[model samples]
Target: MRSPARRAPRDADSLWRWATLSPALLLMAALGLLPVLNLFVLGFFDVRWTDGGSSWSFVGTRHYAALPGDPLFRASILNTTLFALGAVAGQMLLGFALALLCHKATRGRVFWRAVFVLPVLIPGIVIGAMWKLLLNPEFGAIAQVFEMVELEPVDWLGEASTALLAVIMVDIWHWTPFCFLLFLAGLESLPRDVYEAARVDGARGWQELRYITLPLMWPTIVVTFVFRLVLAFKVFDEVYLLTGGGPGTATEVVAFTIYQRFFTEDRAGYGSAMAVAVIFLIFLMLAAAAAARRRVQS
Candidate 1:
């Protein structure tokens, strides 16, 4: 129990902290939460623009009901899921590998870090455009390499078979550095004393990494995966710039599909329904991952 005088200053300090934070909280609620809530509610309505203004009719869950039967929606959902899984896995593997190498290197760590991080710093649009050129069938670096080997040049973005794969690869390249940064931080922060003890106990490189580094880095890895998973689900720029969700809906993703529905087709209700569903799906995935992690830890 504290004296009233001491309690008064503590309360004042607490109030001051909250007072500083309140504005940002309110702003977030207004900018983020309100729009999501509006979208959720809008999904239950048939929204239309009339000559006079706008109209909304309560249609219940028709938009959501249509999702299962809509071929485009089905394709988009599948593509988004595949994109998220593939990109996350690739990023994690390559990033962790790079981090391990960088951690062990006795020289040029800073230079390698700078080079690897450049891709992440580049804008998504720029990456898409750059990769688009690089993957070109004619005159691109890939084409040049193929020509050197007497192999056929691939029109990566123009073919249905390779469009999704190309975009996924580009995404992996663009985002791997983020995972690398997180992983490197995690690796460097690991206890040196623990490693020394492990060595004394006769642990070698692979044994130490397998039994120690991985277990300790698990949290950071999980966090990075979740962040990348969420972002990958929202992928649009690469698909838009590189493939335009084509050579025949091959690279179509949820975010791009939503943009088309809402902006191009003016199907606001259906688009809102799609957005809400994706949001729900992402939440479910994160929850599932968290539960699995907890179970693994226990």
Candidate 2:
């Protein structure tokens, strides 16, 4: 058995650790947990806020029950799913390729890294505004590029067919750099000895990448994939700034849907239900990704 005197120091250290963490825990409860709890509470009721939300009434599961048949909500889900899939896949692939190229280069690595990361340093609102300007129909960036190619000047963000795709493209442009940074970090952390051994055995670039680099970087790939997907699922700020979920709701994602319901339509309860649904979808995605990561590791 350990001495009582020895146990005292360990107990004190544990107390010290919790003491250090208490502030963060309190902050999280106030900022994150309380809002989520309010959303959950509001989800199960009918809340009309003419008198500072004092007009709330218990209408259990009414908003949730109507979710399955809500046309706008369904459209929002479809649009969001499509955007997340397209943007995440594009960003991940482009980012990984760029990371590989940069990692293999011997000169100007810092400059190239900075170039790749520049978009990420910019804010979402600025990116949205920039893209909006670029995609303008007349006398804009895309119009100038179109003139070079002898293509007609077309409104990129004003058409239902192109609006969602345009937003997805903009999202990919801004977030691909984030994925690139993660991939670069993962590539840097890979074991150099294994690559050296593979080279000694006359392994080609493709062979080493296929058999060594990919296998080692699998965890990072999963993490990056999951993170990008989650962030994409929550996309709203840029969409709001650029398109305002317009082109006849073509670009209206789930986040925008909730925003419209709560703030625009004054359906706070329904919006809260949608928020809970978004949380559920995020939880499911996280769970699925965690399971996949475990499978890969095992």
Candidate 3:
């Protein structure tokens, strides 16, 4: 008797699905992957503008090496980290408090929720301009209030010491609403039965929150934290409009530095290198966050 023919494997279905999704995959590759590849390639080249025109020369990792010793670059990195940490910590704390309050409140909850989220809906540039006017030492409302209160008016964006803090405050004001919304959603989605069961076991509100609510909301908190962290690292528009990386290098973030190199100095290749570095740092942060999340989940 002839041997029975072997059955074909089911892998063809997956292949067909991938084929159907090829357009989207190709678009992502072109828009995302291609630019990243070009960026990496350009980072190795030195572009120089001469009297006649411009030229590119292979410079290996020269720009990367130079970055470490560059005071402005170092300051930018430090300031960026500080800004991210301060903004994220402050927003998360304040947001969590607001979320809990709003979730528990019986009266005017909708109004309070709308009030909290209004800042997040505002444009970044507009927010920057508004804050700049409000913080201006000359005729700013804040300065006027300080004068009336017998307190010296602060030049929020005019001093290196206060410029970073000013921007950090603005970021917190704009982003806390986002964290509050996420926390509220997480709280509302939690099963009431779990809390009831805890109460049945003689658990107080604090105990139930500590053991059940926080544990249940851990994933949402992680997601929000990572999202905010990434956005904070790449902050630029507000900083640019608010302080312009002055009164010194105090508010100069990594993104601002990259912009300066790319647009102001016209050092496209060096800016590309900085962009690659930022991308690498982001990947590292994401990896660490993933690892931490897994540890917590396990």
| Model 1 TM-score, 2 decimals | 0.94
**Model 2: worst 10 consecutive residues (lDDT sum):** 47-56
lDDT of 2 by residue, 75-156 (tens): 9999999999999999999999999999999999999999999999998878888888999998788899999999998888
Cα displacement (Å) at residue 58, model 1: 2.7
TM-score of each: 0.94, 0.93, 0.93
Question: How high is the lDDT of residue 25 in model 3?
Answer: 89
Candidate order by decreasing TM-score? 1, 2, 3
Question: How many residue pairs clash per model?
Answer: 0, 0, 0
Error of 2 at 231 (Å): 0.9
RMSD (Cα, Å) of model 1? 1.8
lDDT of 3 by residue, 7-91 (tens): 3334666778899999998998899989999999999999988998989999999988787788988899999999999999999
